[model samples]
Target: MMTALLLFWPALAALLVLLVKGQGAKRVAFIAALVEFAIALFAATTFVVAKTAPQFELSVPWVERAGISFSIGMDGISLLMVLLTTFLVPLIVLSSFKHDYKKPNAFYALILFMQTGLIGVFVAQDAFLFYFFWEVALIPVYFISAIWGGARRVAVTFKFFVYTIFGSFFMLAAFIYLYFQTPATGIAPHSSDINAFYQLALDTNTQSWIFWFLFLAFAIKMPVFPFHTWQPDTYTEAPAQATMLLSGIMLKMGIYGVLRWLLPVVPSGASQWLDVVLVLSIIGIIYASVIAIRQRDLKRLIAYSSIAHVGLISAGIFSLTEQGLQGGVIQMLSHGINVVGLFFIIDIIFSRTKTREILSLGGITQTTPALSICFMILMLGSVALPLTNGFVGEFLLLSGVFQYNYVFGAVAGITIILGAVYMLRMFQGVMFGTRSPETEVFADLTFNEKAVLIPLVIMVFWIGLFPSTFLDISEPAVFNLLNIIQKR
Candidate 1:
């Protein structure tokens, strides 16, 4: 029952938000998001970490003849992902209060609608259902970017749409193929249940091809390396709220997909391609970090930095070490929190100074100590400063990768150095030196902005100080997944 509520509540709220008029929609959407977050927190209380199987399970026949079910549930992983979604969303919506976009109702409504798609993807246990929600999640964000984005919104959004859709088709093909491979049962010859796919024992060759099919889909979403061409543009072009949704939550769908579906479902094929994928992930870490250092646009730099952070997460996951997987899991939460805060800070700077160019702004710290302090904390977290969230996850991830291969681990470690370089450079450039003309009268964070950032700042420390709170929740699930891979 709770699973169903978590899945559908955002959608219902979206409809309610649509009914609202004028700026009331912002309040309606925000309250609705808060209610959804409250429900998720309550649900978390009931989640038993000791149980490895999904709790609050709900399965109903969706296409009886075709062996499809409207199935969803929460394990440690799904719950954490849901928590991330619910937690970040209200902040994302609240952050939008500063900007009264045209058709505020529609803007807020789409955000709520996107939340449903995101939640559905996390909780979905059926392959078809996961795919359904995956596509559903994309639609609102696409519209959000295309309709509300910067001048290049059309071209940038279209490229993003094309990339994702192309990837989706590949994923669908992989799912259909996997569905056909499932054991014949009842009226249908195959099933789309995630467990059924997990139980499949495909030959090496078949698994190899299917691996690429699915990897292409997830890689594009994660925008791993060569396939990441569309990301920076989309992130830059989208509105701040839209960018938050994409970076903080949307991109995690791919990472979640890799953990939940790709690695476990195709372990043999994954093993076959392990080195290749790791190399790509490591390259992205270096490539993106280097690019970020040269970037003048604050938003674009953060966008590239996201690619680097995600690269490490991907590497950790594919390494298949206990530490690596756990690190990946915890890092997902940490990255989401830190990145959203960074982007929100960037948005605040852009809103006030009317510019995001590093050269075009400075000395904000002198005028806006609060903004400077918040930005510094979030930036430090991004660079993995000890006692911050980024450090815990990155430490474990690097350890995991090191366990896999010292050379690769060593290469991946450069992210920390480069990360610090770019982040510190960005911070120093924006907050210090002489004030640019645009930032001469920069104001401090407003009440609503403080409300949005304070919680994120708190989380940066919460996860940093005691990662075990989250690591414990995901440990059992990670072990269970690893056991499945080993057995096969």
Candidate 2:
């Protein structure tokens, strides 16, 4: 029952958002998100990582004939992922209070609706339910970007929608194929149970098809390198809140898909294509990093940096090693926290200065010391400075990749240097350069803005200083997954 609420409560809150008038929608939605986060924390205390199979599992027969169940559960991985979703949603809602967008009810409602889909994706144990929520999560972002986005929102959002839908088509087709291939029992004609699907013994040839079909969807969503063309434009045009959803949490969907669905379900194919995928991921790291260095548009720079960061995460996951998987898990939380902070800072800057061009503004630090300090902390985390949040994950991830192959690890590790170069450079341009006329009178962070940023700053060092706290929660799940891959 509690597990079900984690999924449905946000949905209920979204409905409430629709009915509530004016600013009440934001308050009610924010409270709902807070309550939801509290429930997730409770579940965390209750979850037992030693038991590898899902806990807090709630399964109800949904399509009896097809052997589908309304099954949702949490293991260590599911728990952490769901926790990340709930933890960030309230913050996302809180971050947006400053903007009184048109029809505020609809805007807040869409955010809560998106929260529902995100939470649903993490807990779902049945493939059909997972797929349903995957698309469910996509719908709100489309509307959020399309309706509330900047000038080219319509066009950029259209392209974004088309690309993702194209990927989802392949994903759906792959699932349909898997549904038929799913082993059936006297209890049902076919099974869409995720665990049952894992028991199938398919030839490497067939696994190859499944790998690519699934990869097409996951890759596009991660917007991995070549598939990532839609991202910068989308991020640039979309409102900061929507971009926060996209980078901060939504993109994790693809990484989660790769870890949960692609790797275990088809180990043979994963091993076979591991080299190819790793190469592509490595290329994306350098490719995106190079582009980020050249970008003058602050939003575009972060967008590209996001791609590079995810590229490294992708390489770690495909490494299929213990360190890689664990690092990926650790990085997921860190990336979400840091990226949200960065985007929020950018949003504040744009709101104040009316420009996102790094070259257009200077000496922000002179006036907005608090904001500058916050930016410095987040930027350091982004660049993975020692004893910072980014370092722990990147260190573990690189180590994992190194164990997989020295050459691959070495090339992928380039981001450590490149990320610092560009990030510090961007910081220098925006915060510390000579105070220009435009930035001379900049205001420091307001109370609401501090409320949004303080938590992020705390998290940066919390994870940086005591990463083991986060890692301990995810380690068991990561090992459980590696065990599945190895035993297969």
Candidate 3:
């Protein structure tokens, strides 16, 4: 029941929002998102952290002849991902309050609609069901970016659409092939349940091919190095709210796919390609960091920085250490919080000065002390300051990677230094020095802006001060996943 509500509410709200006129749509959408978040929080209260199997499960035959089921549930991992989605969504919607985009109703409706697909992806327990929601999630964002984004929205969004859809085909192919491999049973002679996939025992050669097919899909979404060509342009070109949805919640879909589907479903294959994937992730971290340092556009720099951050999370997950996986899990939450805050700050800056170019702005702190403080905190979190949220996850991730290989771990550690270099440099350039003409009369954050950032700032400290609150929820599940891999 809870699982179903989490999956359907946003969709229903989206429909309701479509009926609303003018600015009312934003309010309705924001309220709907809040209600959804409350439901998720209430559901969290009923969750059993110690239980490894999915709870609040609901499985129904959706395609009886083909062996598909409309199955959904929450485990520690699915729950965390859902929580992240629900928590960030309202903020994403609320952050849009200041913007008066054309066709306001459709804009808000698409965001709420995207929420449904995102929650569905997080909670889905069936392979085909996961794929269904995975694609469902992409459709709204496609329209959001293409319709409401910057000047190059069409070209940039088309490329993003192509990259994702192209990857989806490979994933579908992989899922279909795996579906056929399942043992005959019931009316369909085979099942698409995730557990069925988990029990598959393909030969090394088969697993190797499956690894690439699946990796290509997940890697492109995570926008892992070499496959990440489409990300910077898309993130920069998308509207602020659209960018938040993509970076904060949508990208996690890829990482979640890797954890839930890729690693466990194809452990031997994952093991086979482990080193190769790690190298690529590490390369992304360094490559993105170097690029970010040279970027003059605040939004673009943060976009590249996101690539670096997720690169570490990807490497940590593939490293297969307890700390690595746990770090990856916690870091997903932290990164989502910090990145959204950073991007929102960027939005605020852009809205005020009509510029995001770092060199074209300066001395914002002189006039906007509150904005400076909030920006600094989010920036510090991004740079992994010791007492901030980013530190906890990076520490555990580095520890996990070190456990896998000291050399790789050492190389990955450079992210901390490089991260600080770029983030601090960005902060210094944007908030200090002589006031640029655009920023000469910069105003402080407005009420709505502070409303959006304060909660994010609070979370940065909460996660930093006591990560165990989240780590405990995911620990059992992480261990369970590792056990599956080890057994394979």
Candidate 4:
């Protein structure tokens, strides 16, 4: 329950700040996000110190008959995700300070509310509670993009909502089916606990249907391949800070769902459909990579790249091996940090120059050396350079795929080379070559900007260089998931 407060405190802080006015409102929001970040850090530290296992912990039952409870707990996997969410929120809030926003208090308040939803999604141990949090998280982001996004905000925001809901309904249906199937419901209806879900044995036919239903929802959220049409518009239209949250933390909600709900609850179904998932993921990676190479807008290019990266993650998960799951989890974290860093640089450039068109931009390194250097490192990481965070995850993932099938591994391996082509081309065009007149007077990184990015840059290198430390934390949980899948 105390862990739950880590989610609520931010909203509570936001309410307090609403009473203040103007710039102070922004400061209050930044402070509130900082406070929440601290609490998350505390929770992470405490969980590790206590040497906790997943506990059926909650303060009280929220809706007893529905099996809905205010339950929340963490395995190593969930805790890492919770930490990532909290870690990024404050940085996002602080980064927004430089922009002149309308109704600063509300903007900050919404961000806090968003945090509550995100944490709720990660920690939720109950299916009904999880779905409730899923919708809750979506709402705040809708407002964030609608109120704070760029020129086409309305259409982009609406598409974002509709696109997610279109997929989410499938998830909702699957859960409803499972809820009724629970023998406790027949004995005398009970709640919908996710942990309880792990124990039930569904017929293969049912598992097959439920698996697709659940996967559809998660895949739409991940926006893999054919389903990814909505991403570019939304990412390009949303404000940079909003984009960071979307790409960095929000997208992980999809991966988390696959881990928390899809894998454990429907292993038989997942195994049956593994090849189908692997095919879609590979297509998305290659398809998006090719498209990204031709992109004119920087944000759009990155958006496509995000789709590709998550595609690989999806493929890794479907591999269904211990190594695959571990790679997927580590890759999720690494992608979150590295992609967010890339987008932050995108935000920095857009904030100063007011355009995302790659053709319109030129050699920024001439003036923004530090910014260029940072972007280059992040780009290299994106391309999975040997010492960067990306390499370790890709290496593990491809290894896992190879174990599954050599053809699968070889096809997935092509992304490593293609990724470099698009990323370096984008990098060389924007950061290196001759300066465009439009960027001629560009200023270097500000103290505030550096403050936001330095930590992310450190993470890129740290994870790249010392992956074992991070991978070790996730091993136990990953092993648990693999065992569940194998048993099924």
Candidate 5:
């Protein structure tokens, strides 16, 4: 099954790299990421060939008395997330080769460690295991930003750490409370199996509070609405490679949590307060989109844009229709790819021009047409232009919302046009106008840069042109999920 391979490869990758000497470390890191990618691909192939129900299943007791086992399984959703994680880590590692960091070994090692934690989160079938992996995933980021970030690294990183941890504490308490309520298993208080968690029945009043506690953790992770204060600073101060990891793959953890944890665990509560969640999500979408229009820094603009998109995704989840949830899942994958591509473009621009301030640059397209073209495609993908990956996901999401409530769908619909405005504004400010002294000396993309981006560009068209390839894979799983929630 390569299930064990999936769990250990990154850790093994990190260990081997640490044994290597200076200058060899980057190569080791890159090779490690590549190997992990291969293993993940092998795992995916195995899943398909076996036609396994909970594909690639592995379960072993980690804490037997507590009914806590190291159980890991992947349906289509987890499989897709693992694919995104594997795909991006290698690119992020490759991107770092050209950049400078103070402690290269530790930096790369942490990246590998972060990969382990991320893969762990998706495959974890237990609640405690999920939270444990979740925290593990953030540790590398905290250190990466604190030790390797820009001028305000400490303050920015600290804020990021504290905000996330604060939210996490509430979740921890909620999980423990739920555990105690689980009929008092003989060997332990209760179990942490996430599937078992779905069976938990609680009053609406209790479910409402519990949902917020758990949802707060994810919302902060997604950085929805008022909880988003930590994102811009953290994104701006961190290195672009780190930012890629944060936005590209890490943010999906929140959406995954919403689908896998929140909706299933508290269906009644989710139904009862869905209107409030819908309002908040729509407001965040519009609010962040407006804020994006004002952003002078390209990274910050993307940061706000990510917030807006996630809010839209969150709204789709609250819609509670099969179509809405399906769209939400599809959007998660598409947005992950689009965001990764955008961050890579931003990193390339920074490398060439030594600036991320959108206002400080102009006429980049004149010298770097390839980079310009790539950026334009990513922008189109971001804005959900027709026949782009973004279009399929947003269309389904909007269709889902429209089916649920026209007023909600109509309000969220503004995001399509608003997104275009901000994305185009950012694109024009950076790529399109007359040449300026700052941009005059910029170089075009290298062979490696194009190599990293081409696959992503192909995916943009592949998904946009034929979304069913991905959508069909998600359908049965989403149906199974909705069926579970509806029955509950």
Candidate 6:
């Protein structure tokens, strides 16, 4: 079925890539990603928004005695996320075309394999399949960073791997517990279906414990607040392309997991702990923004800024309002686009100037107007300038947070100004100050670079100006989720 192919094609492509020799690996990977994107388009275009349940569903028995099933499908929200995944992946691949990583075949193949896991996470209807894909996505990223990353690659990647694995323990436990509790409607006495998970009735106290277990994993993956110590170092040390994957898409897995898996199954537990999550999220916003203001390394600064941005996104989701959930999805997509552009801009700079220290380089604008202009546009998007993608998402998010609690909403809203201060300050410091020998010869954007950036810029305006287009696609699914949560 098309749904199965859409979920698994990237793994197939990764396999095909291993057979290619030399530069052919990049082409095969690029073309494979392109084809995967095209199929994702087909799935999205075919998805009937009117349908409340999953579309293109393909279910089969797996481990029949244990009642596990291999099931996959897409609802409106999952479909939209599928579109984001498929859409960005090809770009992620193309963005790397200019770099000739050693053993290009393995590097590109791992990307494809990761794509397989990402799509699986989004489309999977069975709890076991979802966890399977979740862990599958982690492996390739570990190897990618450890092999191709900076001088501290081994230590940094090892720590990242261990921390993430530790988080997964909680998730695995939650899923197994859910699996045992599921009452079967089919051949098996129990089922691992997500819908069944949503329908469970349990003691409020039990739900609370289950919620924290699942949340620990999601929180650590998003690396929220105190759980976030590992992120900046990993971001700074990983290769630019791998960093893009981590920031642009991988982080979304945590947010998506919370929205889909956590809240639906334990609405009361979510309600019980909602205040705690919000406080941590808001604290992270101020904490990360303040740190971003002081960071000197371009990678580390943006890394901290990401912590700040996603903090607000997390708060919005936990608000548990219709607008809040909708806003979370919008921010997830917008953040994916904007953050990738920001990192790519950094990559372009480092490629040209050989330094990521914001202090070491200056007046890049004096020489590279095109690069500077793109940098400014992405900067504004990050700071959530009106009429940009970030603006639409943040506005909706703030509105949702306000509906939940005005004081926390107002406190969280500080990111608007704080984000701008840090972002523009970083921009002005790097692109507008007196030129140094390091920056005086800075070159303009290359064709390949432009190919990657122009689309991101287009999306910033398109989604900002007409978010309704994107919102409508996911509205049905999101509202359904909120309705379920409120009813519970």
Worst 10 residues of 4 by lDDT: 48-57
The parts of candidate 1 lying over 4 Å away from their true place are: none
Candidate 2 RMSD to the correct structure: 0.9
List the global CA lDDT of all models.
Answer: 0.94, 0.91, 0.94, 0.84, 0.86, 0.90
**Residue 270 of model 5: what lDDT?**
80
TM value for model 4: 0.96
State the lDDT of candidate 1 residue by residue for 1-488, as single tens digits: 99999989989999998899999999999999999999999999989999899999999999988999999999999999999999999999999899989998899989999999999999999999999999999999999999999999999999999999999999999999999989976997789999999999999898899899999999999879989999999999999999999999999999999999998898999999999999999999999999999999999999999999999999999999999999999999999999999999999999998899999988899988788888989999999999999999999999999999999999999999999999999999999999889989988999999999999999999999999999999988999999999998
Instruction: Write the residue-wise lDDT of candidate 3 on 348-425 in tens digits.
Output: 999989999999998999988888889999999998999899999999999999999999999999999999999999
lDDT by residue for model 4 over 1-488, one digit each (tens)? 65667767877887887787787888888877787778767766656523435632564577665656678887778878887888888888878878888888777877888888888888888888888889988887898899988889999899989989998899999998888777664334755877578877898888999999998888888878788888989998888878888898888999999988998898888878888899999999999999999998899999999998998888887887777788888888888888888888888888778788888789898888789878988889889999999998988888888889889889999999889989998998888777787788899999988988888889889889998877877777777777776776
lDDT of 4: 0.84
Residue pairs of candidate 2 with colliding backbone atoms:
none
In candidate 2, where is summed lDDT lowest over 10 consecutive residues?
178-187
Error of 5 at 28 (Å): 1.4
Please identify which of the two predictions, 1 or 5, would achieve the higher lDDT against the true structure. 1
Q: Which stretches of candidate 6 lie over 4 Å from their true place?
A: none
Worst 10 residues of 1 by lDDT: 181-190
Q: What's the TM-score of each model vs. the native?
A: 0.99, 0.99, 0.99, 0.96, 0.97, 0.98
lDDT of 1 at 480: 98
Model 4 alpha-carbon miss at residue 308, Å: 0.6
Model 2 alpha-carbon drift over 4 Å, by segment: none
